[model samples]
Target: MNRTSFRGKGKRVEFPFREAFWMSLEQIRKRLKRSIILVGSIALGISLLTHLEMTNVILATYMSSMGSTMEAYQFWLIIVSLFVCGIGLINANLIAIYERYREIGTMKCLGAMDQHVMKLFLIESLIFGAVGGVLGFSFGTITAIASSSVQLGINALSFTPLEAILRYLAISTGLSVLLSVISTMYPALRAARLNPVEALRHNI
Candidate 1:
């Protein structure tokens, strides 16, 4: 397949995935506050999920019994939290689109394609998700261990299976990334479809 190229200064510039990836990173850096907010949102949701799952796993290990009733309740709570998180993420991305209207317009005017815009946004979301997931997992696991220690008097740490903990960590992190990407889709699409002239004229 032929690589996509954009026109700039009368020259055809190849806008490869690698360039988009770097641009995404630069965008995150430039929009540090927004990026931090996005990451925090992802972390909050992931952390809540991780905390509950880790708690359950620890309890099950120590007691050799799972609490179906409590698990069900917590599962619903997690679902609600994730739903809220998704909403927040979508709102943030939309706001980002609004804030960057001129930038987007300029890029589009400079020959940036819709897919290029979408790729950049998606890449940024992916980076935020991965970072947030790691942070959330770490925080959640620590919180779980501390709480379990309080109840089980350090025996919890000793008895907790490393394999199970690692497994959950991987699962939780992957879920966080998935959630972030899914949540950003609509906003990314909207941004990609923006009319260059209208976007350039849009007042922030």
Candidate 2:
């Protein structure tokens, strides 16, 4: 097979799959970076929320304890922290989706099906969610295990129940999936509705 290359001032070459793949990969990378940041923000917010919930649970169990006031402050901190983080994540993904309109259009021009484009975004979200889940789960488990022995300045604490920890992990993973789905929906819809000619004309 003879492959033609445009050189010097001769002919303008047609785009090939190899070139398209690289271009798409670059676009995907850019999108992924943005998504990762969003994920970080979302996770931070969720962790805060979890922290607040956990504190409330503790306080509920120790209603007669003297440190309920301090526990309330801790609970508020966790809730507020998570709220901010969640907002950051949502905005980051939204911006990324908007920025990639051109690339989405390009893919459509090259006969990439709308469904495939949606799947591409979905796969990216799944990859991020899976990796984040594994890391967060491991870290939380380790922290819980380590907390078993630590003598807190405020109060002596027992190890977190393993079953309770696993339940938390399951819930977190479920929420991550929900967020991924919600994040992908608008972008996927836009990609599905792209006009090929305008898509190609769309600059970064």
Candidate 3:
């Protein structure tokens, strides 16, 4: 949605968000090689996160819904699962930060402001994170459902599978986007702070 705003002298100005968005997409495309791993890492991390979340929900549900005794090992399972997922998230984003220093420098040298540079990377991460979330949710839900169905009837997997799936999807999506943006902040800041000339000398 485009909104009219006054900058000065009562003149209307158009914010170029659509343009900036497209440029961000273009930049992501240009760096597809670098982006692939980041996206994959995010996807893997989100998948694990979603899986862990679902396990917690479903196990609790199973206990209440089916009246099963909870096992001691399950507690350790959840902790380990979350620990592994956290590691993946850290590793992937760190690698992306390491790889993009030159790109950041180039953007800085090209008259991009600090906020603009940060915005570009933040937007890119959000896009990647969203994609990763969807993929992760799909994989996590499918596996969870499949494994659950093998132990219990498909009908008993939940009160309603679709409702549960949608809920998990929403949860995973929110978490993935949040993590992506947070992970991106330091790198974005690093990029934004680079001296343009020094950056260009090394990166460009």
lDDT of each: 0.86, 0.55, 0.66
lDDT-superior candidate, 2 or 3: 3
Clashes of 2: 1
Q: Write the per-residue lDDT of candidate 1 for residues 1-204, one digit (tens) a residue.
A: 122246455565446887788778878888999999999999999999888888777888888666513467788999999999999999999999899998889888878978888988999999999999999988888888889988898787875679877887788779988999999999999999999999999987
Tens digits of per-residue lDDT, candidate 3, 1-204, equal: 122121323453332456667777886787787777767766776676566556555655666665333356755764565456556655665566556666656655544567776776788878987988898887876666666666566743673346667887988788777777877787777777878776656632
What is the C-alpha local distance difference test score of candidate 3? 0.66
lDDT of candidate 1 vs native?
Answer: 0.86
Candidate 1 all-Cα RMSD = 3.9
Backbone Cα, N, C clashes tallied per candidate: 0, 1, 0
> How does candidate 3 fare on TM-score?
0.73
| 1 or 3, greater by lDDT | 1
Task: Kindly report which residue stretches of model 2 are placed more than 4 angstroms away from their true locations once superposed.
Answer: 1-32, 56-90, 133-157
Ranking by TM-score: 1, 3, 2
Top-lDDT candidate index: 1
Query: How much is the lDDT of residue 30 in candidate 2?
Result: 61
Candidate 3: regions farther than 4 A off: 1-15, 52-98, 153-160
After superposition of all CA atoms, the RMSD between model 2 and the true structure is 8.9
Better of 2 and 3 by TM-score: 3
